[model samples]
Target: MTNEAFQQLLQGGVVLLDGATGTNLQQAGMPIGVCPEQWILENRDVMIDLQRRFVEAGSQILYAPTFTGNRLKLAEYGLDDQLGAINQGLVAISKEAAQGKALVAGDMTMTGQQLYPMGELTFDGLVDVYREQAQALYDAGVDLFIVETMMSLQETRACVLAIKEVCDLPIMATLTFEKDGRTLYGTPPEAAVVVLQNLGVDAVGLNCSTGPADMVETVRKMYEYATIPLIAKPNAGLPELDGDKTVYKTTPEEFAQDGRLLIEAGAHIVGGCCGTTPDHIRALHEAVCRLTPKAPHASHHRVLASERQVVEIKLDGSFQVIGERINPTGKKKLQAELRAGKLDMVRAMAREQERNGASILDVNMGTNGIDEKEMMLKAIYEVTGVSGLPLSIDTSSPDIMEAALRIYPGRALVNSISCETEKRKKLLPVVKKYGAMFIALPVSDNGIPKTLEEKHAVLDELLADAYDHGFSPEDVVVDALVATVGAAPTSALDCMATFSHCKQDLGLATVCGLSNISFGLPDRIYVNATFLGMAIASGLTMAIANPSQDLLMNTAAAANMLMNKEGSDLAYIHRMQYFDKKEAERKRQEEAELLASHGTAGAVETAGESQDAEQGPVNPVYQAVLEGEKAAVVALAQQELAHCMAG
Candidate 1:
């Protein structure tokens, strides 16, 4: 189905989705430990009857019984060789059952293999798997695609990318959150909404982990950030053991009552999950059919997200710092490490900057004697493993940027898209495709604009081009083109004017390389911090800077408080508390190092020992992997294996 058509359907009212596929099929004599898709094809009449009941009972959309039809899952029953036949057969059955009454969505789910750094599956490998299944479903003429019961947000992204690569089918994704309202991988509901919607999912929400009542709060959380439709497909209730069988005790009436609460809590689409039947969907439809669906929250809220956190960028919100320490431009140590294909320094920098309150981490892997794209991907994997902060993919190469965005697994901020011919031609489409927010540098083929008028003109042209590529102002963060004050006396003033114009006149967020204003000057930190305060006053949204500098970070906090930005007072106070705690820890580490420096046998222990002592309890193997200590990992693994074998 076209996205426009699907949206028009939602505009009519609440979109009712069909209830439980696996659970209902099991009740229809589908045996356990057998391939569900294969069984459905063998007993097509039973499957058709069940779905037809849902359609008659008021399900506007029916999920085809292709949930586990992906190649990997079918391989468990040795049906992988017939993957195409199984998926096509299942879609055909659902289409037959629909009989023009409802639309058939090609259902998808997790591959049962975890993504890299957790299990063996690589991101590209998983995408290829979903691509094969999605192609089969598309060939079978499924109207749309729905990826449900996803535990990993990364895996969901793979599925959406796969489907989009195959066709422009309307895709909806839902995660199964734990009772505490986070996925098994620690992604919260709001993060899921922000990340998936930004990745171009037609609808994003929760399904299967809990009953309708317990899902209300998470639905509300997702609603606050959602710019697309929200879906709630909760179970009948918490499953219970009844003798030898699993049962859901909530009656259809109770399920229907909670379904109304879900609609009220901002779910535009409502459905049933485990233990829900046609009767339950009928009750739910009766309960919520008349109520007006809640409209999705309006877009243009500038936000970036990692897998676990969402960072909102506002024109007047707290000043955000995109940590700049991960770049290997002038850092000789980092450059050497990158050349050796080691990401230990990169991982350390990411963790340190996050601890220092960086809102985003800027990752730039450009260096001599190293493959930039290869190192960039490696850096992304390492940083995401250690930090929950969203990353700024800083690269001058469009090819590298596309490679990074394809597998980065979160909503990244493209370090820039300028009006330069090569950049506009190559980068804009990929940025839009990945749903990334980008730093719009107002430099064209003629180079830096000499005047504020010229700069604004460049920005206007770039924005017009972005619009042509289907981007909104919310997706564009204007770079105010920071020129050195040492070169132009009025450079800082011009930049502040650009910031004010972008914020007040154009209604867009702004960012800058914070230290560029003070280049070729003495005590650059003071100049940098002072300029940052002024920029924040003039409506700067975020800046790429070294967040480890207390002066710059404190000035940002103080500026936010002075501007009376919401929650800045508490934020400043909390920052002070964190500083105090950090200072105490630093002093304790110093004393421990001093004591260890003078060993009892006059052989000074290394600083690593002192730090390890202060940190308490170490998993050496895990630490070795985290630090990218390849030799240490090999030695440690061999030692552990030898011990296991000897025992």
Candidate 2:
């Protein structure tokens, strides 16, 4: 069986893997001073017997005994002359142990060196060592490459890239980190995950340096940023030598329990590394078999503190909500302010919408006869300073659009462009160059299309043109044009139908100025709210609306809940509790004012009252006596108690 086949076996369920070949070899009569790879070749029977025991112990994936067989390390043993002969012999020994029942992964480990700028190792030289080793393993027909115990991202990335150049086999890489969850060079777990994921490593994880308990936390962090499958191969525990023999203190049961916890944390594949034995892998297999992994839910895109937020534009769906609060659209005050180049107002508006749940903010600088470019620049800078929420730069001027994107951090959604060649040629390049997102309107030089077919035709051309300009299908959002329902009877459905078509055919996301659907209509809020529900069901990713409006904000929250898009309901539930409290308080105040106007003017009283009234007043004759002694106070007390009793 090939190593790839073993990975396939791992995918089907838990697959046992042998561990600690070097340590095992040291214990099995191999001299400690000699290279383990050379010693294993010299005593093939010892290596074969080790693998046989592991296979009998339930290991399905047996790694060849060639941990330091790379040319660079072999030279230290003065055996650089026999690199191929040694590797071939090691593979032969592993294959014989496999007996056609197990898979053999050719082992590669860190060179016990560092790479610059962290250390003296050169990138090219590191790549050369990995490339040389990878070829030797590939030619020997080993199952896969396990580049384990990697400590530096630079070196790891180089080795992985070099291995890919020489072989098409799947690579499983693991980096060793310190107890603080950082590589020796300070690479955080999440950063390492993102870097490795983006590099398209098949399975990435932690190994060698950490034990099972520490590996669980690190694996959780890795799973957060990783899109690919994950692997966790932690050490049994840090070893301490006892009379020339190193010993890992963790029992097989303890290590197995930790392995199961790592699997729960989203490691699809699990095994043991340094100081681990065949018994540990066997127990791990049993542990994994008894456990059920938690399936990860779909993730919402978020802008993290360290990375600028990104808003993906989906233009071809039903209706997109392009948040309008950022633009000086309806407010003459805001328009005048923008024209005057006062950007603090813009920043405040952006922050408000972002806090109120704006997915994408729409920015427009299209004021009467002003330099749109300059206004756009100031607006972009000012808003981005306060809120890193992705923007939809709303402008028709190419120059203004280009300039806004230059300063805006992260990927942004361009307001729009038609299918016209001139607009596409000018705008698409700018989007491509800045890695900006965009929206495409279904209109050509002739203007906005009147029918669904015309709309589809324009959308197709726009998408095709966008792709020609290096835009991926994911980067382009299609706006099917939300025409005013009040203006034309066919407008609303046409927009929705176009949205549906784009989502299904073009596979692009859609956006619309939802308010435009009810423009000039009486009771616009009702129409806007109803239209929004329809649009969301139609696959709209975002919108440009006043999130401050209760209806819009409530609708988005409710929609997220119903659609199961929001991860948790704690925030919404808490907000509802606050609302319930406010409503109760308002009712209480109104009831108090009613009672005070009709009855005696006194402090509000609860249903249970008169507990502190004078005990003597409990007697009717005493009450009558107090009525005359403290007439006003007694009268007020009587009124309150009477009201409470009546109620």
Candidate 3:
């Protein structure tokens, strides 16, 4: 069926799907330990009869028993040579069973071969395997595609990408979550929803891990972030070992009762998995047919995700810091390490930044004397392994960006796209295709805009192009174009104005490089910290900055609290507690050193050193802000806002 028709079908009510192909076939005298696809094809009459019973029992969608038809899986049974015939025959059987009364979904799943960094199966190789099976299913004319019982989100992504490359069939994907609400691979249900929905899957959810009652919570977690329909094809219940066979104990009535809970929790589509039969599907249909389907989320959240974590970007939420130390631009140590083809430093930096409270990490590998694309892929693989923070793909090369996004196993944030005709033209489609949020730089082919109006014009042009490529305001974060305050005394003011404009006038999130305004200034940390506070007060959503700087980080936490952003009070208190502990440890080490020296002279010298430290020049305003002296900080914030408005 076409995507339009599929959507219309979902609008009618809960889309009922067929249940338990393999188990039901086993009950029909297809023996265990045999190839399911081969057995189904050999016993075509029985396959048709079972599916016909489902169609009669009110299954709106029937999955063709081609789940194991991929090249790798067929090779397991020495039926590799007959992959096409086996898949086509199964589809034909399912179609016959449907009798044009229900839709037939060409089902696919994992190849039982683990993907790379874990096993020998290359991602491209796996895609090719699925591509081969998808071709035969398309030729045989299945209505839509359903990839179910998946345990790996990346594997699901490979199948969806392969099928889209082959044909534009409506695709639905569901992963099986363990009892702890994560997949076997540690991917949580919400992360699965974010990753799959962004990859253009028409519907996404969990299947087969447990019964409907247990699956309801997972469905609810996904519903908060899902902008597409959710599918809940749960097993009949937890499996039980009965002699030599595994059985589910849930009766059709019990299964139906829990199926209603799935609907109430936001499952737009419902079905059964292992241990379910036509009776379960009929009971589910009877229980939920009249219940109003919960609509998908009204708008897509501005979110970035890794395999296990999601970082949401909200316009009025707590300020976020994108760790910027991963780039090798000015870091001699990092650049040297990258040239030697090592990611030890990259991994270390990822961990350090996460500890320093960075919401996202920016990874840029544009140094010389290395294959940038290769290093980028390696960095992505290494960093994701070490940290759960989502990456911001920062590269000037479109080729490197595409390669990273293709293999990087999460929703990334592109560092930038500009209005420089060729750059936007080449990269916009890649970003959209890979489902990445991007930093939209308001730079045209003419270069940085000289005036706020020119910057606005550049942004307008770029956003128009982005909209043409199907990006919404939530998918973009505008860069406020921070110029050096040393060069232009009003550059900071211009940036603050741009931040306000992006957030208030254009309805987009804004970010800036926090250190740009501090270039050529003495005590750069002071400048950076102060500008950060002003920027936050002016509506900046996030900043790319060095997260290890205590002054900058503490200023951010304090600023967030002063602004009364959501959850900032507890965040500020926790941040301060951590710092306090670190401070106490430092003093303990100092006392130990003093004791080791062991004299009144040593104590006098240490006291003098402390006195000297306290006598150093300080920025009282910035210090008061960091210390949470709310009266002074609030007054300064008000003054800064008044100045910003007056300017």
lDDT of each: 0.91, 0.71, 0.90
RMSD of each: 3.0, 16.4, 11.4
Please write out the lDDT profile of model 1 over residues 65-160, one tens digit for every residue. 999999999999888999898899899999999999999999999989988877889999999999999999999999999999999999999999
Query: What TM-score, to 2 decimals, does candidate 3 have?
Result: 0.91
TM, every model = 0.94, 0.52, 0.91
Error of 3 at 73 (Å): 1.1
Q: Give the CA lDDT, 0 to 100, for residue 512 in model 2.
A: 76
In the range 375-406, model 2's lDDT, one tens digit per residue, is: 78767656654565657788988887876665
Record all residue pairs in model 3 with backbone atoms less than 3 Å apart, i.e. clashing.
1-143
Q: Which whole-number lDDT from 0 to 100 does residue 105 have in model 3?
A: 95
Clashes of 3: 1
Cα lDDT over the full model 2: 0.71
lDDT of 3 by residue, 1-647 (tens): 78999999998989999989888887889887889988887789999999999998899999999988998888888999999999999999999999999999999999998888778888888889999999999999999999988998889889998998899989999999997889988898888888888889999988897999999899999999999999999899999999988899999999999999999999999999999999999999999999998999878999999988899999999999999989999889999999999877898799889888999999999988898999998888878877889999999999989989988788999999999999999999999998999999999999999998999999999999999999999999999989889999999999989889889998899999989998998989988999999999999999999888888989999999999999999999999898886677578668757776776677756765665586664555675554434346777777778888999
> Model 1, 265: alpha-carbon shift in Å?
0.6
